[model samples]
Target: MPIIDNPIVLSDASLVLIEQKKATANFSHANWGDEDLQPVRREIREHYRNVQRLVCVYCLGSVSAHSAAGAPVEHIVPKSQHLHFMFEPENLCVICPDCNEFKSNRESLVNPVLTANRVNYPRNSALYRIVHPHFDSYDNHIAKFNRLYVECSDKGGYTIYICNLNRFFRRFGRCDELVNDVALAEQAERFFEDGIAPEQP
Candidate 1:
């Protein structure tokens, strides 16, 4: 994941709808009509896919519009927990299904009251306990080894733990087995090509 510029350009009607929802305290996605919700949903996915280069903002997982599990629009501050920011552009990001499912309604704010009082979207990453896609650069926190996630900062560590980044590695041995086998095959290839084998102890 990288710090991607938000490319979603909400239509005037959509903005009006958001404002109306805010005024009415009606932030439920299920309640919105197809005409209002569908376009916004489509635009969100399209723009984010382009801006994020089709990578999940949380785990850097590959996301494809054509995939069985397509990228989902995620609320950085869960809408359930922060209704005021339900439609805030900065609060929205695209994430993989697994990350989204695991992170449901999980709070990320360093201070809820401070975050809730923002007149405008906050730009300071320090305000958040987790890496905010809008406010923080992904590489600054997390280091990656193939599919393995390594935390370089507290935010990265928290994000990995909350999202269960190593879920596959923990639930199954296939990841390690596949990686080890690939390494072995590559090593054998190098030996065969060189017509030499290094001395083994």
Candidate 2:
């Protein structure tokens, strides 16, 4: 690995030079990345498959679930801003290439906090109530549709506005099964929670 030279890095000059170099080197072509460097987004598929099973929550399907076993992991928070969320385990979810390339460096992903049955945008609900996978659960906003596409929660609607899920979903059709799966998973989680009987705080 190469250590960055501190003296060679000027503050403003460094940010600009780095941005230009990264863009040119990575996005030489709209969808292509520089062969020489690692594609940051590849973390979606690479890490999950290494440790855990890459199953589609909606379809309950494995990598083999799709025609190809090469689905890329998507950053619900978009790695561009939440660089911290870049490699978060909860951020890793299996999605086809179409969805991946479409949603690049975007934001406004819905948090699955109190979402059940269907995701709802409770933006008017409260503050510090932001959507975060590591801190929150996707079960709130992401619903698995008939093994088709992922449905957005009420709050998810706001998220899609930013991420352009509408435009994308139009092409893919309704993700009824995906939504149902999320509802089922949420129910199970609730059952386990209630069944366990939490210790009083």
What TM-score do all the candidates reach, one by one?
A: 0.78, 0.39
Native-to-model Cα distance after best TM-score fit, residue 56 in candidate 2, in Å: 4.5
Cand. 2 TM to true fold: 0.39
Model 2 over residues 64-112: C-alpha lDDT tens digits? 3333335656555555544433333454455545445555555444343
CA shift at 64, candidate 1, in angstroms?
2.5
lDDT of 1 by residue, 1-201 (tens): 236775466889777766665455444644433465666667667777778877888878878766535787888887776766666778887888999899987888888886776767666788888989877877677655456666768998999999988787778756554357776556445654764332221
Give lDDT: candidate 2, residue 189.
Answer: 55
| Reference-based lDDT, each prediction | 0.72, 0.40
Question: Which window of 10 residues has the lowest lDDT sum in candidate 1?
Answer: 192-201
How many clashes (backbone atoms < 3 Å, residues ≥3 apart in a chain or on different chains) does model 2 have?
21
lDDT of 2 at 134: 32
Off by over 4 Å in 1: 23-35, 67-69, 173-201
Clashing pairs for model 1 are: none
Query: How well does model 1 score by local distance difference test?
Result: 0.72
